[model samples]
Target: MKLIISYKLDSIENVIPEKQIEIIKLFSYSKSDFIVRKIIEACNLKHPNLEKIPAYNILKNNLNEIINNCLDSIAEKRLVNNQFDMAIIEVVIIDNGHTLIMKLKDNGIGLGENYLHKLSYPEFKHTKSQEHFKKKEKDYCIGGCGIGLFHLNAKLAKNDAKLYLKSRKEAGATIEISMKKPY
Candidate 1:
């Protein structure tokens, strides 16, 4: 797949540049160490001191959703098309002493045209999966109940997080979450 992942480091005003880079680098390193490391390394280009923060679990969940739900869906689609179309994932972070914000942008097929509206409702649910995804990878499986985002959002909300999602059919999607730092 023609996938490119990039980081917007300049927008992080409150965090020191070195620390911002460190955090971003940590995120990239996580991608490399993901379950599908080879596929990630093949399709993507070669890409934190917060060892024991309370938000670590939350961050891990977010990473899981980003990979299993977001990027995996894109990869599955590519398998069906038998070609790699262009896709981009951009991560932007803003950290101040009081609050932290992370935004992700992806050019992969978005959460469908009406997903955002449905997501606004408390009872929203949907699953987009393909059989090819299961057959292509031994370590991965296809099928989801579509509750990952809901659970993640709920957890974030309980932590006083603010989330914004903008998505479209062909235009891709942007997800931004802002929350307080637990330090």
Candidate 2:
């Protein structure tokens, strides 16, 4: 069986580069630590102010949305191909409490160097994911509004927090979120 995922990407294609830089810069100045439960909790909050203002407070209100949204996209695409699997979204603290890193992984479609071209530095904007879903493609999906990641990138756009992504063509994809120093 063959699968085709089709959608217009011109609008978002320009966002990758600018978004990448902003996200990394935001992470540069950290001083925040997010517990797994908070990550889960913040996902439910509709507001962008995920964390209350205070020193040493880890703010990641929309993390779950970002990860879950990505998963939803993955699942949608899989459905088109009649494939199924759980996309594990994990937040791992790599260094001491001073540094934070998150990993959103999926055993779905792996991103290649070619896919890298689509990345852009994120910015605050209104985006719609439904566009990526094309009726002509069964194994394809229109991801959530780009705002999820863009907000994440902008929110983390301090002190060099970096968002990295890796994809293995037929394997899947993994997104790494890391910040250099915490407040």
Candidate 3:
């Protein structure tokens, strides 16, 4: 029942088109802020205050949504005793000046085939199941609204970015976001 999060930020010169970067997964939820701060620093924004920057806010909010989704998926899988002792979330950020690519992988219960298909739509829909609602009360469900991904995609679209998601039931999920640098 431990959460291990890790991330790697590749330098612009070191980045290869399809090169696979290795990330050593270690750390906990409490250290997530440090990881994020490292990513912001890697962006090399000239602004004195990151919070006041639009791109910074967008990136931070998107990351938070993805991380929360991973946590929720892990929690649900844990309820069914389908998850391992350690839940890992590995993030890779590749910034090459023009483009910013973020890849987040999680060891958690993944989206079902039906649910994944539904995600293609542009409307609001509940991604959770009735069993989920019954087990975790509606008020207690952390991400029951199921609009996080929708909003994430909309925000990305506004910034001329794209989102790609891949998942296998009971295995895990990978969310990749490719956006232009500096929003």
| The candidate that achieves the highest TM-score relative to the unseen native structure | 3
Model 3, TM vs. native: 0.66
**Candidate 1: segments with Cα more than 4 A from true spot:** 1-56, 77-83, 127-145
The residue-by-residue lDDT of candidate 3 on 55-161, one tens digit each, is 44676766655676776776666666543456678777665667667788887778776676666587658777877668754444544345788777777777667
What residue runs in model 3 are displaced by over 4 Å at the alpha carbon? 1-35, 45-56, 134-145
Error of 2 at 50 (Å): 13
Model 1, 1-183: lDDT tens digits are 233454442343444476566655664456434433433343233214332333434754466565545555455445444435654576666656666666667765565655565655687765344542446566444324457766777777776676777777555678787777555
| Candidate 3 accuracy as lDDT | 0.63
lDDT of 2: 0.46
Ranked candidates (lDDT, high to low): 3, 1, 2
Supply the TM-score for candidate 2: 0.51
Model 1 reaches what TM-score against the true structure? 0.57
* Collision pairs in model 3: none
Better of 1 and 3 by lDDT: 3
Q: After superposition, how far is residue 64 of candidate 2 from its true place, in Å?
A: 2.2
